[model samples]
Target: MPVRFVIGREKPGQVSEVAQLISQTLEQERRQRELLEQHYAQYDADDDETGEYATDEEDEDMGPVLPGGDMAIEVFDLPENDDMFSPSDVDTSKLAHKFKELQIKHAVTEAEIQKLKTKLQAAENEKVRWELEKTQLQQNIEENKERMMKLESYWIEAQTLCHTVNEHLKETQSQYQALEKKYNKAKKLIKDFQQKELDFIKRQEAERKKIEDLEKAHLAEVQGLQARIRDLEAEVFRLMKQNGSQVNNNNNIFERQTSFGEVSRGDPVENLDTKQVSCLDGLSQDFNEAVPETERLDSKALKTRAQLSVKNKRQRPSRTRLYDSISSTDGEDSLERKGSLEKEFKQGQEAERERSY
Candidate 1:
């Protein structure tokens, strides 16, 4: 009966109903057993009182009687007293105990169902919260990726700018080095020019002193020659006067001889005096002509020396032109080097840009 009750209660909404039906069936069975015992006692009394029919065939063949009918006894159905056999009519003590047990079991089952429902609800809520958190996390990751990409682009731009700056710095440094070298060379050239100028000035001073000395020597020589010419002039004048006196005495002697031819033959002295006067006149004229020629030669020598000194002063080259030439060359070379450096730097920059792309 317990197995049949368990099998019946397997269907939906049947466990509680099956428990009530089993209790009612058990009560009916107990009432039927009591009724059968009463019927058997009456039958035994009737058979003992009928002593004349002790051997009657009817008595021997009589069967046990049922409460309602044969069908009610076989199937354990209620008799016509259906109200008496109802659950309410059964003993209250046993039914109440069974009902209490079923109530406790149902309460425990319902409490468990409530606990399961609460657990399922908590699990669903947690799942929703986790899904929201995951979405937010995915958005944050995308934002970080975008920021990283921007940073990478910025880094590349910064690197390019840095490379350009470095190239400019290198070019500037090279230019500065070249300028330094040129400046040093210019300084040395200036020093050399200064030294050459100093040497030239010293030379000029020496030449000037030499010229002064030559002028002094020439002046002294001129003075000596003039003194000598004056002395010769004085001597020639004295000889001329003596020749005149002798010539006049010879003329007087000749006039006496002509006037008195009978005089002595010693009159030859007049002819001799006349020849001495002619020789002295010729010598005086040659001395005067030679003095002018000597003076002219001394003047020519002094004029020649002055002209040489003037020429020396005019022939020296200006220092400015030499320095200008040197500076012009330096400027040209500097410009060329600057152009080459710029071209090389530009080419390198273009190549780097191409490689990056």
Candidate 2:
């Protein structure tokens, strides 16, 4: 009878180095078993009319060769004829012994394979754990880099702000210095101008006082001259009465008139006082006349009386008013005042002539 056996072929995931080695060994054992079965079948077909049996030497030669040496064969089956013996029985015995040794080796290999499988599963689990740790570490590194980028941007902005502030401070300092210099210059200029104005005011006050004194002296001189003229006129009248001559009397009167004219023309001070008094009278009269036209009789009368009091008793500052304002005069206007004063004098003379007429 022929025999066949099934061989196991595991899936790719379940296969390993040890499993492949076991498969190859099983394949070799199956081929050897098939060869032994073929020899047994051929030996059974041969016709030996004499009941012959295999000798010890042939049994030894027919036995399968093993790695160590030739082993003794076992008797497992009883021969069909008790007296008949065959060489196939010896091959069967040797194969059965090999099968027992292979079974024992297969059991030891299965236990070692089970231990190896357990170790492989642990190594795979450890590899998976290491991969997870690597992924987490990468995420941490990326997040740290992002944070560093944000921090670097902040540092750059801070540096810019610091630079701007420094520039602004420098500019402000320069501006403050310039403004301070200007302020100091202006202050100095104002102080000098004030001193000059004060000096000018002092000079004006001295001139005004001097004019007042001169006016008083001229008034007393005019009074004395008037007395002297009265005495001379009295003496002339007595002489004319004594002579009783028309021509001589006319000569004396002509001489007196000529002397008065010479005195009035030569004394410019007297003419100035006369014109000044007349100008004040004209101003008072004009104001009185205009007041009546513009106001009620009672208001006009009061205003007129007040003006008359001022004109009669107070010293006037008409000459002072004639001076150009110091504040308005740029030295050029002050220089032009002389020509203007001459024209004003001419106008005053014309007005005085009209008054005499």
Candidate 3:
């Protein structure tokens, strides 16, 4: 890509170089044309000067004469010496010969002028071609400059975009690094948490097993003690029954002794007629009676603890209803917030559209 751009850029420079070359060639052509024009002008001026000299020579060839055309009268106006001739006797032959020479020189100069004119015309034509080339070169230069400006602008914009992309990539890389660190830390924490959870579960299982064993042993001991108590209660009832039978036999013996004493008192009544007086006198003074009364008063207080076992046979729905009501309220509030946000977003979009328009 850089090579392409360099190539593209070099094209404009090449165009500029060509323009410079064309300009230089045009300048050289112009200089040559000017020199040719100057040389042509000088040749034309020399031709004009030579023509003026020939015209003067022609005027001289037409010598001054008398009003009446008489060559003899014109020669008589001489001084005594012929060598010191009069104006009329001035030499016309040499003047005529010089005029012919001036005519020949003028013809040669005119021919040179004509040749110079031809060369000047050719130079002018070359100059015209060079001018056309110069104009085209100027156009090419302008076009190249415009293209160069466009390419430079494009390069600058591309560089800016590349810089922005690089910056964004750097930021993304930094964010990735940060996220990687966070992920590693989170992973370590998760591993530690899992290990601790495993240890906790193991400890809980061990404790549960220990408690179950203790419960089983305690239950067995309680059952054994209950059986022993029942046996002791049966032995106590048997000893009470044996003691009751012995008490009944002793009561019967006491009753017999009382009856025998009553029979002995009846026989003594017949033999005692004679001694009736005496007995009556003794009995009158010896009447003895004894009565024993026993009374017992007892007060007792007893404290007993009675336990009543009550169980709930059914679950209540009211507790579930309370939870449902709370959750429904939360859900409704969340929906309302969502609606509000959506409305706000729509309003913002509409406002943005209005601003854009």
Candidate 4:
């Protein structure tokens, strides 16, 4: 029979060496046994196969018949039986002991082979497990690399976004700074304008006050002049009344004489005409009045004309009423402008803060 065995590549070198030695020794022993059997068969085939028999006998001779002379002669032949040439008991016993020893050695060798086979199988199983574990580790490594790459990409993107946000913030800061500069300039201009406006208002107020004072002085002067004219007019009126009464008395006397005694009519008429002409000329020269030809024009018209001249000198409105409204309106407008400016300033401050952020 052929000998077959299995071994694992992962098996230890020492074990394989030991098993190889055992297998070589067993094969050599088997070859020796086969050679021995072939030699015995050839010897058996070469032996003679005669089926003849042989008997053993003894012979006596007559030579010993003389005196003590009768001597015995004996002849013996070997037996040719198969039982006589068979192996003895000692040889059979020795062969049986050797066969038992070979059987025990074969049993020990079989046990070693079985142990080696079991060890080899265990080693194969371990190798397969190691290979599987290695494959799993490799796959894990690939997955980890992919994850690391993804994390790196995410980090890069975040950095880029941060950079963009920083740039935007810088731009906003620049814009806010520019706007703040404009606001400051505007504020300065507004302050200057407000100062100018205040100065203008103050100057206008002073001018208005001066105008009012001048108007008051003029009115006072006009009133004083009016009082003096009234006094002069009264004096002139008293003189005119006195002169008229005297003229009337003279006429009455003359008229009584004409009634008592009739004198020459032409001479009295000429004297009366001369006296009337002199009285009219004296009245006109003293009073500075024009003589009215008609009696219908002689009432209060002449006196009213002198009084109207004084009153008409003050033709404009009173200073207080006119200037008070203007001053009040100016004050209100200035207050409103100040409020609007303050509001704009506050808005500018808030915008500056927002830009700073």
TM-score of each prediction: 0.40, 0.31, 0.32, 0.35
- 1 or 4: which has the higher TM-score? 1
lDDT (tens digit, per residue) of candidate 3 on 264-334:
65565444333434533342232111111213211110010001011223335354334444543554564
Best by TM-score: 1
Backbone clashes in model 3, listed as residue pairs: none
Worst 10 residues of 4 by lDDT: 51-60
Candidate 2 lDDT tens digits, 218-256: 445444544543454455445434433533453465467
Give model 1's clash tally. Answer: 0
Please list the residue runs of candidate 1 whose C-alpha ends up more than 4 Å from where it truly belongs after superposition. 1-140, 227-240, 250-278, 281-357
Q: Candidate 1, residues 1-357: lDDT per residue as tens digits?
A: 121212223567555654666676566546654675576466557646752222334423432431221211232432576574356555554455556645644554455445545643564565567679889999999999999999999999999999999999999999999999999999999999999999999987887677667656655554565466456556545654564565457557656766887556865756545554464456446545533334233344346545764767745533532443354355456446545644653464345334322
Candidate 2 — which residues are off by over 4 angstroms?
Answer: 1-144, 234-357
Query: For model 1, which pairs clash?
Result: none
By TM-score: ranked, best first = 1, 4, 3, 2
lDDT of 4 by residue, 36-56 (tens): 568646644553353211111
Q: Alpha-carbon error at 26 in model 1, in Å?
A: 38
Each model's lDDT comes to 0.57, 0.53, 0.50, 0.55
lDDT leaderboard ranking: 1, 4, 2, 3
